[model samples]
Target chain A: MTREILAVALLAGFGLATGSVAAGPAEDLKVYQAYFEQHFPDFTPEDYTRGMYNFSQDKRAQYEAIMEFPPYEMAVEEGQELFATPFANGNSYSNCFENAGIGIAQTYPRFDAERGKVMTLGMAINDCRVQNGEEPLDVVKGPLVYIEAYMSEAARGKAIDITVPDDPRALAAYEEGKRIYFTRRGPRAFACYHCHWEAAGARIRGNELSPARGQAANFPAYRSKWGEMGSIQRRFKGCMEEFGAKPLKPGGEDMANLEYFHRRLSNGIPLNAPNNRF
Target chain B: MPYPMISKNVALAAVFTVMHVVTLPLMAQEGKGASAAATGNGPEAAVEQGKAKAIELCQGCHQFKGADQAGTVGPPLLAMKARFPDPAKLRALIYDAQKASKPYTMMPPFGRNGLVSEQDIEHIIAFLYTL
Candidate 1:
């Protein structure tokens, strides 16, 4: 056989093999974890849950000092009260969630077969309120965030365990989420992949960029810049705005799907929400 | 991967060649009266102005050769004159990298976004040539 023809045959065979096989969630998880482990040998999967603190010792020290008296304590306390308080119909948030809504934050952003959509913890909170004849709280901030903060506190130390079902709908949502993450958009023209994936551990101006791994672990976090608690969706909105794009609606389909994919990246990282940040 | 990438690079180079030809006359015109930094000023003054502009706009994400305290988010600016022999291609990259090169680049569209002017890009390009 001629060298050129043989090379073409080999390439065609390789293409066929790769085209038939798609990477499943397990493969994605393995590769995702491996990438971070290779890039940052010093960090345990658990350390990634702390966000940017994993990149800098100085930042970690400041974070440790801040953690000694976390400002989110009040918000967590209020959330605990809100979670337990009976609705107008005398049924509480407990009735709607498994395990009475305690320590279950890690399993959230789950595919809801009944609802035919991805349901975030914030969405579930609103769903519970709507079901119990109470008005839904603000989806991105305020009381909804407090509840999510409390749930994250309750689920502390539990590893993230997001499951994508065998259903085609669930897989479609996940693929869409993955697309949203890697596709560049807006005037600044950056995908979530640009800053968090490609430039992770690098400095942007004075601020160090956080890794995509374990980013989902600390939500409903207290950012010093915001001077208040914010949910992952709120952070998403802020990031899109920073990209000079119109912010996606919080708890919307796109945001939930993005959260689903993002949370999957932190699959093995333990939940550590209500964390403080600079 | 190598096969397709080689072909893609060749195609990109052809596109850049055309762009360089089309833009050379306009660039020459701008050089005559754009600004003191871009016009008849000596290469030293233009390079100095370009260096200042690079530090102000690009130092946050990219490091220049022989520079300290510059960022590493983007690749270091080294051997620029060799890397981009066609200066118009470099100008196109700084103006709108996505349009000039890869579509998914993290580099912002400094000129298109009004973050930097055409004259500013000229100064920055002059400084980059030195590196």
Candidate 2:
């Protein structure tokens, strides 16, 4: 065969082979952990859970002062109150999760072979509400962020430990999440990695970008820009629109899978949710 | 394997060629964007516009300040006056930088992919000239 045709044949064969060979979760975790460890050499794996403040010393100082009078503390108190209050059926979020749903944020966004999809903590809380005949809460703000903030606060210092089941569906969901994280789209054609990975420490106007590490640990975070509490899902939509791209639905499979993949990337980092930021 | 990310490396040769070829013919009569920077006295308005775009887009990679300091992605644009003094070459370079630089330069083809308009690129070049 000619050189050109031979090259095409080889590429096609390689593509087919790549499609068939799915890597295991442990392998994925190993590579992802080493990536952040190498990039942010200054911070320990747990330090990433500290969020943007984990970078510069000045930023850290500012973050500490802000934390001294954290604005998100009230939300946690309110969430605890809401968590215990019985619904019309006298059922609470406690019925849906183990250990009364306290300190379990690390084990969430898990692959459920029975559901054939991933299940995030927010989704589980909403499921409990629905089962109790209560209207489901929105994942963006209000009670959703409040409750997640409370759960994350309770689970603070719990190491993130998501497990990608051996099932093909679980692996496929992870691959899809990885694809979304890397795919460039919209008017700007900027992917998540474009800013977070390739240009992690660079400044955009007044805003300094954060690296993708330790992000999952401090979610349901407070941003002074918004003057209120928000979830990682909220930030994803904001980032997408900022790049002049349309965002996916808030609690859809895409969002959950993306969360799962990101959390896994920061695996073993302590969960320190409800953190305040700029 | 996870350091640089596999997704980034998935950029195939075919995709790059398709984008560069499709966007090259867009070259047309000059817009006011590039000239504003060269003239020096053109209203600071156009320069500001260009600066805004650069701050939003390119600053993530290329530092426009002294010695092209900061940033780890692309080379510094601090010396654009001598490096890419010609407007046409600058425009072409920004449009499909990877193609102009090499087959695998990590710079995104902002022009070819419509990430930034031609007028905007001229404005970015105008801002680059000031640096």
Measured against the true two-chain complex, the DockQ scores of the candidates, in the order shown, are 0.33, 0.14
Give lDDT tens digits, candidate 1, residues A1-278: 33233222223233443346587667767766776776678888677987788777998999899999999999999999998999988999899988888789999899999988899999999999999888888877788899999989999999999999999899889877876776566767677877886688998766688999988998889989899999999899998997578777887899999999999999979998878888
- Write one digit per residue (lDDT tens) for candidate 1, span B1-131: 11112232333335434544655576566453345544335556567767877877788789886455677798889999999886777777888876676555678887787676565676688789998
Off by over 4 Å in 1: A1-20, B1-56, B65-69, B78-86, B96-104, B109-119
List CA RMSD, all candidates: 7.3, 8.9
Could you tell me the fnat of model 2? 0.12
Pairs that collide in candidate 1 are: none
Q: What lDDT does candidate 1 reach at residue A49? A: 81
Mark the 10 consecutive residues where model 1 chain B has the least summed lDDT. Answer: B1-10
Clash-forming residue pairs, model 2: none
Models 1 onward score TM values of: 0.80, 0.78
Indicate which candidate wins on lDDT: 1
